[model samples]
Target: MLTSAPPDDASPPVDAGRSRDAADARFEALARMARGHFGVSTALITQLDAGRQSILAGAGGSCGATLAELASCGQTIADAGMVVVADTRADQRLRDHPLVIDNPCLRFYARCPLLASSGGTLGAFCLFDDKPGELDDEQREFLRDLARLAAMAVESDSTAARLQEEADALRANEGRMALAIAGSGTGIWDRNLQTQEIHYSSGWKSILGYADDQVSNRIEDSYRRIHPDDLAYVQASMQAHFERKTPSYEVEHRIRCQDGSYKWISSRGKVVSRDSEGQPLRMIGTTTDISAMHAMSERLQQSVDLITCLTDEVPGLVFQYRRLPHGEAFFSYASAGIWDIYEVSPQQVASSAAAIDAIIHPDDREAYRASLDTSAASLTPWDLEYRVQLPRQGLRWRQGAARPRRLEDGSTLWHGFITDVTDRKRIEAELQEFATTDFLTQLPNRRHFMKHIEAELARIQRNDGGCAAVLMCDMDHFKAINDQWGHALGDLALRHVATILREQLRKTDMAGRVGGEEFAVVLSDADIPAAMAFARRVQQRLAATPLAEGDQRIALTISIGIAVMTASDASVDAALSRSDRALYRAKESGRNRIECL
Candidate 1:
């Protein structure tokens, strides 16, 4: 739960008549502004008292509950800055609170404090919704701006009430009226529309760095001091108020200061008097210098632009990924390169990762999810190489690397990069094939075959009861064929025999060329009878097929010797030696017949 400060006691009590009505109107306007700007379901300006919080103004819903039941606003005031809860149900501090469990049932909430000029937090400007949501950096800054405006409106209302109470006293002392206006830190203006003359207080002249006598009372002179770009907008606002189209003339624009530099200012006024025909006769308002706020907004925008430009130019998908405690995940920020990597736009996955997940290879999807879960649990750097089936690229490989950090909200956030690694994976597969394959026959070479037999021997030892057979086969009179028909035909004959071996063997069997004229085979889960049957099929197939090149027909035959591999066998070489001895016996017994030992 969040620690909250005691309620502020510095707030002045609000009076109940016209002053309260005016304050409510201003507060409602600000609440509506907050609701529209944030696109939330509800917005409110709430004032906090000793033990209760009251809603001064609300938009989108009505609060029927008592002031004491709404404790969130008091917490916001104690925060003294912005506070965001992405999901109220996921928060320990609010999940059991009455406001969350009852009507409105808020899930998302964001609040900014309304601070008094005396440095006390008096209330809060808040936005909320029934669905879980979050805000970006720019949205947070905009909320702060709205909160500042709400605070200023509150202060202005209080000051207006105080001045009205002292109106009689001020009328008796003219100097005191001027002092009160100046002390409020804002300038006052009175305009006579019929006479086309304006009167400004000493505070008003001082805002533009001018003495009271140095400025003119002519309305045309005031227009000349406004920046050329802002003249039309200012004039339009003023004309609208004069025609009674708007309730007030309120505008923020640039004005030329005494030093000839433009400074931003906010001007507010309303017609206080009218003629018999309803023509505007007089207007009164206040002006506030807002150059500092305008400058800060400009700098913030520049920084945001710079960061966006840099991230867009990166070659891979640079992103911030977040995984909630409930196993939900999304990409909060993704760079432009997301299009090339996942074949999906960044905006498509900004709120959910389902679009990207749909493209992952079905066979690899489980491993992908498991890898992330492990990394998130341990808070380790995640590294994964996975395949994806993209719409445009077909089958492709991707490599991702990220560092995970646990957040205060029980979510894991990662700063990561994902890049297309299809080319690298293809190269690695090709290199592996070259190392293990016999180039001419496209079968396993001697070294790879020996390693395969060793693995089989280990498996036999582990299981202790399965039987396998190793066979050694020699091509009959290979040397004579090479000498008479040339080495090329002899090589062709060897490949022909290799093809027969492949065609006759079971899927579980292995075959490889171990010598110039010799081949080896391993039959898994086979006994003596099964081994002899396989040898006869290979010999018959070889004799039935002949190599014929331009009417030269050559019939080939292979002699096979089979030896059973037993669990008692010391090594793969021991089984091979027995098979070799059996081969010599087959050759001695007149060549073409198979022998078993």
Candidate 2:
């Protein structure tokens, strides 16, 4: 039903202006071979120009067609490789094609591109059938071989001359190709599954420390060379490909070298030929030595594991902190101890320090930022002790020390450690309290009390209208009390008087047990009359509150002397002597009375 034209008499000439008869005869032989090999009804060697396709030669009653008529062949040439439509009517791109809907309706079509020696696609070697059919792997490979022949025929003046030239070029490049493959530590392999014979390239033999003549070509010999532990795995991988469960065979395993030691290798292959039942008949692949890569990977893992172990065992949070030039800061690395010190996980601060910053005591956060800024500016060591109010631990102290380094990117990185120092800080505070406090009454001891007096005197000397009074008080009948009630009652009496004095004083006033059965008070900002009134109140309170224990009552009284400490007094002793003289006169008169000097 389809029309055909006679071969164009004015068709473009073939390569090198070969006679039309000779070129057609050469291509006709290749076309006939393709038809017989694939059992197709027709095969055509066609040459394409911009407008139309010219049949250079034909087999099985084929004729010339235009480029639009052989749409599948044009696609093959565009693909620059084999293209097959098992059923043209079943293909979306070709279902409406002219050749598929017309007389001699093409049902199946397959073609391979005819590549010129210059690597450009010239046309395609095409097959056509009136019935839908498919090509197996073996048939596909055969079609490719035939297409290669067609390409050579189109490029050459004579087939024999082209073959000789190809042979000479192959001989010339063989050494260089082998050297390159050997230098790259890659080897080629071909296996005939039917014959159970294998061939290795010279480079492949050299990988195992063997010369080309020293290695065996038998497939069983190749199996024996694989390490015993890896042989079963390698066989399983290949079997999977043979069963068509995998697209190709690929595996990494050990193989025994010529010296009886093992080297790691990676093998990859694909089935190139198969029998009628689809069982693989031949395979081709490459092998690469991977022992060096494997060893380096193992060493890298060991190093990572070692560093992890060391960091976990350290006592504090060992960390790396980075501050960008734009003033953004984060901890790049932190050990597990971050949980113990900051009550937060390491991951919480990995990208931003905001989580850690939120826990810092509000009063100390400004100081913390300032310290870091100063250190970064000076490129100096960062050392700080600050407080944090953690969710789990409440207010706690942390001590951190680090050395800052400027990175090449104009950022700063600090390698540092942060530790919980709350316990140490508590102990220091307790020691300080012990040094300044009286053991019996918990008041400021004489030494500490004198420091306050000196400070008050200095304030008065500053001439700011500051006035203060110093009072010296001595217990009357102290010897009699100790002898009658034992020193235990005497000490209780002293404590009882101390309690009364403290209760009567204002926050600005200070009292201390200055000596055995003697006490002193400094009334800040008080004149002599105000000081005398304070002394009389203390005397009356002690008289009323006698020491009573187990129905035994012991009366207590103290004689207080007040001396106005003027700004002219150079030292604390001047005021102390005046107060003592006044106290003597009060004791000589009635005890339990207040006097002033």
Candidate 3:
């Protein structure tokens, strides 16, 4: 029901063949104006030939039934020259029509006829729809007026055949162009700035999940279909183009379909023509899919940014090198931290092979060269650890590992990791010291002493060296001292004994406090008599000093047992057991004494 039930006089009369093109152009303009007032896809100017008496001048999708059919039904208003379809199915004449059956999607249509100057019916201006609907009297009169204007344009042509020829040619070209655009997978749109009218191709409507016939004149309809997040940006770009600031523009945006899902599209557009004053008259645009491309670009940028940040922030020298065409090494990547770690800038490292070679310790230079030679000759990975002499930082260790890559020109490329291992090397040395020495006394502990004893035995066996002795000393009444003076004074006495023993021992001997109140000393190059003499000296020293606690004098005695291991001694355990037996005997004989095995 798209037709108006208005009086015929409401619309102006038409003249024939005077200004056909001008009249049709006016019809197009009137449609553009009426779009804002009453939203519709388009208002068209059509003419049926003289033989087609029923629909000669006008046509509408729903109400433009055959003239004989409408006449039989008494539904036509010749005076007003308008046809309306309140509801396509409800109208008996149109329910079984071919348009209704063929295009089940369309449910409404309306049209108004225009008069020729010769008082003959020529053509009509029409509005079409896929919906069945009613139009009020006011809407009907407005549509009738639009039809009258369209009729004037058509009849102004010199002959009806000429007018019809132009229409046929225009439609043929438009049809071919529409097919091409649809196949190209591009959405096309035309916007008229002066009239605020939009002409969207079928492909464009398909992108938005709508039939081309369903489009409305309102621009807000297009805006609402765009994704909410992308709406502002699209609007801003459009405004900028409207201001004549940009001649052409491109933007990536998201568009929402009828069911409310969004797809990423790349929009590209150009302003085709401008007013005489240089303002934009119309713009044309197309949209293409770019979601996958944008995603890959973003991922690549993230990876590059991550690598850049990590290399800049990490400590120590990091170098990667590849072999050049000739057998020379050339740096590919080096971090800024190389300057801090090597006291040599990356620039110096990359300047020449001799520059890096000069920094290597003399002892390691030849070995490093051999390693590189081996790597270049074979496909195996290169891994080497060595020391370097920094200009000011003394000797530092570095570890390098690389894999060989054969390039297109038969040249080899070595990508590798180089890190300063100085701090790790220092920590390892400290750990080895801590493992062997007693933390409190700074003397070799029981474990280290045993190891040294075994070494001495091997030395004596191999070289027929003289025997050494193990001196075991036990403090007398040491527990009683702790009870009387508290453990602090007892600690002081133990330290005193340790100091005296150290002063008494030769540089070749090793000493350690193995247990509470007990100390052992190994005389590496001393025989039995010499060991006995040394033990007696330790005993005498222990007795001579009476350790004091705040004027409370405490006399202390020590028992010493010396086990002498001959050059032929088989095991250290036997020697240690013999020392224990002698020590018990010395305690029994009298506290301040030394006994030998």
Backbone clashes in model 2 = 0
- Per-candidate TM-scores read 0.61, 0.55, 0.44
Name model 3 segments beyond 4 Å from true. Answer: 1-309, 322-330, 353-397, 405-413, 462-466, 504-508, 536-557
Give the winner by TM-score.
1
lDDT of 1 by residue, 356-390 (tens): 88999999999999999999999999999999999
Better of 1 and 3 by lDDT: 1
1-597 in candidate 3: lDDT tens per residue? 213322343232232333323434445455544442454433445454543322222122224443233222222223445777656667765676555555565465566666765677665655555566678987886676555555555544433355356547777475666666664446778888788877777777776677867887567787876788889998899878877777677788887776777777788888888888878888888776555445534644665577657886777555677676676775667777767666766677574556678888999999998998788789679899899998788898988888775664777767667788888989998999999987766777888888988887888788876777888888887889899888988888888778778878888888887888888888987878888888777767766877776777777778888897767678877777788788889889977778886
lDDT values for all models: 0.82, 0.79, 0.68
Clashing pairs in 2: none
Question: How well is each residue in 1-597 modelled by candidate 2, as lDDT tens digits?
Answer: 111322344323233232334546668767766775567778867766554555666565322343234533334223566888788778775675455556345778888877875687667788887788998886886677666666655554333354456547788475555554554457878899988999888778778888889888899899999989899999999999999999999999988888888999889999999999998999988887767556644644665687768886887889899999999899998998889888888788888998888999999999999999998999899999999998878999999999897875889989899998999999998887788777777777889899999988998989856679999999999999999889898888888998999999999899988888889999999989899889988878887898997797878889998898878898888998899899988888888877889
> Cα deviation of 366 in candidate 2 (Å)?
2.5
CA deviation > 4 Å runs, candidate 1: 1-252, 265-310, 324-329, 406-411
What is the C-alpha local distance difference test score of candidate 1?
0.82
RMSD each, Å = 12.3, 28.2, 26.6
